[model samples]
Target: MTTYRDAGVDIDRANEFVEYIKEKVKGSFSQELVTEFGGFASGIEVKGYREPVIFSSTDGVGTKLKVAQELGVHDTVGIDLVAMNVNDVLTTGADPLFFLDYIAVGKIELETLKKVINGIIEGCKMGEVFLAGGETAEMPGFYPEGVYDLAGFCVGICEKGDVITGKEISPGDILVGIRSSGFHSNGFSLIRKVLKDSGVKLTDKIEEFGKSVGEVLLTPTRIYTREVKRLKSQVKVKGLAHITGGGIPENLIRVLPRDVRAVVEKERIPENPVFPWIQQLGGVEEREMFRTFNMGVGMIAVVSEADKERALEILGKDSFLCGYIEKGERSVKVI
Candidate 1:
């Protein structure tokens, strides 16, 4: 007689894993999280909004996970997973309320799962969102041993009138860019290819980055929730873009009105050592590099020229006046 355990899915181990992670998960809870673990559905209180709008986003860390796996580091990927989703909802001018995660692994590894959970908890704390619930699935045949995938779902709320849809964006809006920690979890398909083709090992130390290749590559995606919230409160933000996969041109256009185009001054962007290192190693073109990576700027905000100084004051020294909006076809130009 064949059993589920014989097929490599151990029911007892799954139960034990859930029990182990319960407290760590609870560490992220805010007062809004009403339901606890072992529930069919999690519950959160809808409060504070006279007319509330719900904003949600789901995303994964993409191929960056393969690097983490290669380095035997599983903790920071969880933070990257949460940052991807929370930052998306933040673009809508929402306050992140809760987060849920999905983890699928070939087999349950208690210590590894614990590290991931701790990372998620840290991300939730950084974003000030609740760790409401999540799922952990062990499917032996679906994934190879010692391998897993992570995805996250984030929910946020804003007053209906407060949504930053970019409809208000027009010509003369100054674009301010916030610096990124590093790559922020996109374009790794090309990154891995470049590394492999160049024969750079994960353990290889590069003096420019002041860290090993794996350390730089596995840098966690920055969480922009707090910065964005504070900026919105102080400035009249007409548009917001979270730079990701398609980089500046692709992401900034998402928030521009039809009559306006974004003019980003590439020279104005602050330099980061890792990007130049990647460019040298891969021989990637400037255009391709901007299109593939954040290139130092992680988030961009459109504000009226009159409000630029105040916005910068709120964003502090790391932010830069990257460019402005102009009358034209709906597109972005990196000059």
Candidate 2:
């Protein structure tokens, strides 16, 4: 008689895998999480907001996963998954409450999955969000052996009146640019193509960068939750933008009002070695580079001239006054 295991799906192994991850999932829980891991659905309690506005975002680490798979590194990608979603919700001045993850793998590797889960838990701690629950699917034949993909969903809450939608953004508002750790999980499609065409290996290290290609590429995306939350409480932040796939120009424009433009002073953007290296490797142009990568700036906050000092004070030295809003049609210009 044929059994399910013969068809590449192992019910017994899947059950054991779930049991294995239960404790790892529990490590991320807090008082807000209302249900255990094996429940029908995860539950969270929303409190402390007089008029709560729920903010949710779902995102996945894109082709960047290829780097992790190639290097046999699974942990940091989970942090990238959480950062992609939680940082997006944080754009609206919300405090992330909980996060859920989805992992799909060709085969269930307990140690590998555990490393990924541990990274997710670490990311949850960084963002101060509870790891409410997640799903892991062992789909053989659909994906190549030893390959997996990760996606995450994050939910946050904010008072209705405290949402930073950029509606209040006006001309002369200062644009504060926060430095990115590295590539931050975007623009990897081009990165891989360039590296492959140039015959660059993951272990190859350029003297300027002082690290292997894999090390720089696998760096976890930074979580801006704490810095942003603190800045909002201390300053009048008229608008906020999370720079991701579209880079500075595309992402920053999303939060600009119709009548104002963001005039970014490119020189003021802190130098990150990765962008210069990528440009040299790919022979990419200045505008295309800015259009495709963060180019150093990851998060942008617009504050009035009066509050710029306090905003910078709260954001600390990792940030700088990179630009200013100008009276123009709705757009962003890098000059």
Candidate 3:
């Protein structure tokens, strides 16, 4: 007789994986999370606002996952998974509430899977959000035994009146750039192609990076929620931009009003060593570099010229005056 396990789906093993996930991620549960584990869905009670609007964002780790698989490092990408979604919700001045993840693989490896779960728990704790629930699917023929795909979903809360839609961004507003932790989960397709053709091994160390290429590449994306909360409380922020797959030119322009453009002074932003090392190694064009990677500016906040000093003071050492808004159709200039 054939069973579900015979059809490339292991019912018993999948059950075990779920219980393991429950025990591992309980640390991220909060008083606000009202649902128990092993449920069809999760719940969070809305509170702390007289008028609340919900914000939801979902994202994957992109090709950066290839680096993690190559390096046999599963944990950091879990953090990157949460960072990508929460930071996007944060751009709207929302308070991240809870997170869920989806993992798909050809077969389940308990040891490898646990590391990824622990990493997700760490990410939820770092953002002060709850691990509501998640799904792990094992399809024997769909993927190879060791390969897996990860994606995350996040929901955030904000007052309806407080949503920042970039409608307020005006000429002369200052663009304050928050420093990136590294290459915060982007441009890895190009990075991989370059690394592969250049005969560079993941274990090979680039002297300036002070770590193996794999370690540097596997560096998890930064979570900006903590920094953003403080900035919003002190400054009358007109707009916020989370620099993601599109780099500064594409992501920054999303928050600009129809009648304004952003002028970013590239030199004003601090540099990360990984970018230049790859540039020379890949022989990639200057314009393409800005179009792909964060180039070290992770998030950009638009504040009035009057509040520029105060905003910079609030952001402290990690921030820089990158540029200003000018009167024009929506666009971005990275000079």
**Which candidate comes out best when scored by lDDT?**
1
- Per-residue lDDT tens digits for candidate 1, residues 126-245, read 888888888999999899998999999999999999999999998888999999999889999999999999999999998866899999988999999889999999898999999999
Cα TM-score per model: 0.98, 0.97, 0.97
* Candidate 3 lDDT over residue span 141-246, tens digit each: 8888789999999999999988988999999899999999888899999999998999999999888767999998888888988888999998899999999888
Which consecutive 10 residues in model 2 have the weakest lDDT in total? 27-36
Where is model 1 more than 4 Å wrong at Cα? none
For model 1 the local lDDT of residue 207 reads 83
Give lDDT per model, in order. 0.90, 0.89, 0.89
lDDT winner, 1 or 2: 1
Give every collision pair in model 1. none
RMSD of each: 1.1, 1.2, 1.2
Task: Indicate the residue-level lDDT of 94 in model 3.
Answer: 92
Off by over 4 Å in 3: none
- Which of candidates 2 and 3 is the stronger one according to lDDT? 3
- Clashing pairs for model 2 are none
lDDT, ranked from best to worst: 1, 3, 2
Alpha carbon deviation, residue 140, candidate 3 (Å): 1.4
For all candidates, the clash counts are 0, 0, 0
